[model samples]
Target: MSRRPHQIAILGTGYVGLGTAALLAHLGHHVTGIDVDVCKIEQLQRAEIPIYEPGLEKLLLSNTSQLTWTTDFSAVQQADTIFICVGTPPSADGTPDLQFLQTAVASLAPYLGRKQQIIVNKSTVPIGTGDLVVRLLEDLAPEFDASVHYVVSNPEFLREGSALEDSLYPDRIVLGGLDTALDHMISVYAPLIEQSFTPPASAPRPERYTRPAVVRTTLQSAEMIKYAANAFLALKVSFANEIAGLCEHVGADIEEVTTGIGLDSRIGHRFLQAGLGWGGSCFGKDTQGLISAGREHAYAMPILQAAIDVNARQRQMVINKLLRHLRTMKGKRIGVLGMAFKPNTDDLRDAPAYTLIQRLAELGAVVTAHDPVAMARAEREWSHLKYSSAVNAAQVFQRADAVIIATEWDEYRQLDWEALVATMRRPLIIDSRNLLRHPLTAQVEQVGRELKGTIGAAL
Candidate 1:
């Protein structure tokens, strides 16, 4: 591990890039976050964060002197290490679109200085993308010597809401590069690897992680690790939902079933809660990418395909439950709570609520949705749905025939059930995330249950 600091330039200021920039700066490295979005760069310059991640604002504020926000690609020429953290969204065929990644590499070609630099890919891309990048660099910079640049795969595993904490104290750090590139990456992340950095007073240390492990492998293997990890997690959630469906038929509680199964050493409790299924920037795309990769090699991943199929069905299952209770969605006013993919973030990419809202609209149902931090994004992306700016939970339920809990935000868990019940036209509640705990007068239907019950009687 090199004790000396290095100049790091991170491309894109979305969740992964900004978190990495903040963490690198906090580790005493001079970091410059580069993005094409002027608004995002201006926001960071003003000490304002563009995304919702716990403790990120504090991390950015404390390390502002060490961080630089810029839109210029020339900054890459001065950086000792360049991190490509752009988004690789899914294409029409479900394969990851590498246009952003390719464009970033091409943009850096003209600015490649004489100094040696390492380009670390922090984006979750398909396997062999590192090789593709290397080839592209070779073709683009034919005039420059090959020794001036090295490509490495360093995928990010940071969760949206807890990104800062995860970046600071990750379960493990993985690096996929050649022998020449490994030393530099290790030097850049040495403080994190050795657990030598002092934790900020504002962000407490995670009790579970005393020291993080490092996994070194080939670039292709490291790329697969990112996809495999996310795909397995998606499988776990889908498995839970499958069991949840059986639990409903057998009149068993999914919570108790998951607890019992998760107690076994082979099975863990993480991602086992049965609800509306996973939605975010990672799981769906990665799973689809894995499947697409399998197909490219003439192999079929039936289990992974099933997991994806189950996840899609779970969304329709929520709509099915609503249909069963409401009899007809036509002319019914339904309230949807928590529009974001998951709690603690405003990201709405691939959210299950989108399917529910679209299906409800197609049925001629009057839909009104609300989220703590995602309303503006939802209103912008999904302007068709009616949005409420009401602060009270009861206000969201006002004049609604039924209310469906979409994302499990903590505030939704503490809602005054009785008050919300009074505001609704039909006093019906569909708990998609299984977040409700209190007894209520409204009729309630949740995951793993066929029969509807009043909140007081159900509890």
Candidate 2:
């Protein structure tokens, strides 16, 4: 059944909100991207995207006829569905601080009852928050209770670099609400659920991708799903790192071991990277939040606690490697290639590169780093450090004692490594991500590569 286009209001213009707005508008919905940040709103209005998400600018700019950017809360009055996409940063105790979510809901309460609409929580909030939202909204505006508007929990599963692609063909569209509100929610995502809409020119549908499954469950379950999923992924990476540590002593290669085990159907190869550990906004925050939430019930999660511990140790391991190569680094110049947590993004939230660089600088090492897109953001954060930010990767190796491959950017993979190594004072590389191509003539120390085998000698 074909339904008329819904007026969707996405609150907060962060990565999740912006990606959702672009995807919804492309799927024939009239989307209003709202935010409290005046500068962000003005930037969007001026055809400028504050963040670096691939295909987002092209999608929004191409489909400008169906999108609106504003700072007005009154836009909710016409919205058939309102999404709260605010950030819920982690507090000191590792629990999610929901101050942003609370404020967004408070501002949205008065605007209800213009018509019956579905208020969806797309933010990654704590479990049972759906019930809390209902009660809070009832207290704020008693007139607009469950009868006037329905509250739904729809947690986001979008990744940072691949947000648009993930939203377009999600693994699953989880809807957590009562029966009355679910039909409306289904209608809003029918194009995606049924795989009916033609693919965008920039983001094409995969060759063998089937229709995405719609998971119907209770509100609390949906919230739990998001946290559990992220935690599991973090555990997987940590597990690989732990095993890699053992592999080093047992004279086994981690890359070959992971490749052999990943061939099993039950253990498909995905997050088995034994690099400088996982980073960005989701993994650590979500894992720690789940562990903290468990503590509230007087429960202990030793597995999760260990996962977090292993991750921190990974960053420290970089320093251990540095000391092994450059003994007594009271005065040494170290070059770092790739600063962003991962490739295809400029997000530096809890990035391993930041942690590694900080440790290197504290040990009296003169640090110089290079990243394709993250230099400007990193400069603002690391201005106090005695460091130089290089525009290109080659400039970083000038008179440097050693270079660390912190991030696995594609541009770094295709670099003329032989040429770059000639400029460095010490032709040594700590390829943490295992990214450098083979057929090397320089000394390279990878995370899991056997210690005895010389990668063609002479650093």
Candidate 3:
């Protein structure tokens, strides 16, 4: 059943928020994007994407008239559905800080009228956070009492580069809140619910994936679902890396091993890419958040905990591999290719490159890093680190000991192999991602030096 267009406000114009906002507008809803950064808002107002997301800028432009950008929280007062897409980053103690969510709710407290509005939690938050946000808002706003303020946990599973596409045609749409408002949500997303909505022109047309049924459950279950999904993915990735390590010891090809196991249909083969362990905004934080939550319930999640531990050790494995090849990291000028977690964006919040960079630099190595997009953020994060354009970055490897492939980007794979060997003092390379192939490997070995990779051994 097609319904009247709704007013939707997305808080935080970061990758998740902007992508959500643009996709909603494309779905024929009136979207007002609010952000604290005036510069970002201004850029969005002109149909410019503040961050790098594939095909996002064009979508923003197409939906410009329907999408309004602002830095005001008062816009929430008029919103029929308010999606809290702010960041809930984990602190050092492995707990998610609710500062951003608290601030967003408090700022919009005064303007929330008696009229009922659906408050949606669209960020990746700790389990039971939906209830906490509701309690906080109710406690903060006394005067503006509403009979119905349904707090729904609608956690986003958006990958950075493909966020917009994921938003429009999601694998699932889990809504957790009062069953009373289930009708409203179904009505609100009826277009997608019916599969009658058109995707943003800029994005790739989604293959007709089975339309996900809206699972209505208690808010707690929905919150748990998000953490579970991410934790399981992290676990799978770590498991694959562990297998990759074993493959190295036993002279087995991880790629073939994964392929054979993946074809079983029981494993399904996603997130099984044996490379540097998983790192990004989601896996590390979500795992830690789950572990913290487990402690509150007097349960020990050893399996999950070990998964996190193994991921951390994977970084050390890379470092150890580099150490084995060169024997010493000191005085070596290392070129780190790809700094962002998964590439196509500049988000370095929990990027594995952070750990790799600091550890290498601490070992008395001068690091020269290059990312197709994230070098600027890397520079800001690591002030002492140096940046290089793609063309000249290989120069850092000149007279340098080892080059570590940290992030796998398309451009990084197509480097001039001969030139790289020619420029480097020692043409040694550590392929952390196993991104290089036979031709490149043979070339590197031709120069009386061998390139070592993680899939197994000193090939």
TM-score of 2: 0.96
Give the alpha-carbon lDDT of every model. Answer: 0.87, 0.87, 0.78
After superposition, candidate 2 runs with Cα above 4 Å error? 381-386, 451-459
Our tally of clashes for model 3 stands at 1
Give the per-residue lDDT of model 3 (tens digit) for 1-459: 647899998888887888788777887899988888898888877766667888888887887788888988889878988888888888879899989988888877766777778888888888878878878887987644446777888878888877876777788888888875566777778887776777655765667665667788888898999999999999999988888888877777787788889998889888888877888789989998999999999999999999998898888888887787778888887777788988678888778888888888789887777788876666667676433434355655676667777887877767776566567767777777877764442222111112444432222
Clash count in backbone of candidate 2:
0
Could you tell me every candidate's TM-score relative to the true structure?
0.96, 0.96, 0.93
* TM match of model 3 to true structure: 0.93
> What are the per-residue Cα lDDT tens digits for candidate 1 across 1-459?
678999999998998998899899999999999998999899988988888877888888999899999999989888989999999999999999999999988887777777888989999999999999889988886434567688999999988888877888899999998877888999999998988888977677877678788899999999999999999999999999999989889999898889999999898899999999999989999999999999999999999999999999999998888888889999999888988899888999999888888888889888777888987777778876544445555677989999999999988877767766887889888898888765477677889854434445333
Better of 2 and 3 by lDDT: 2
- Regarding TM-score, does 1 or 3 come out ahead? 1
Error of 1 at 160 (Å): 1.0
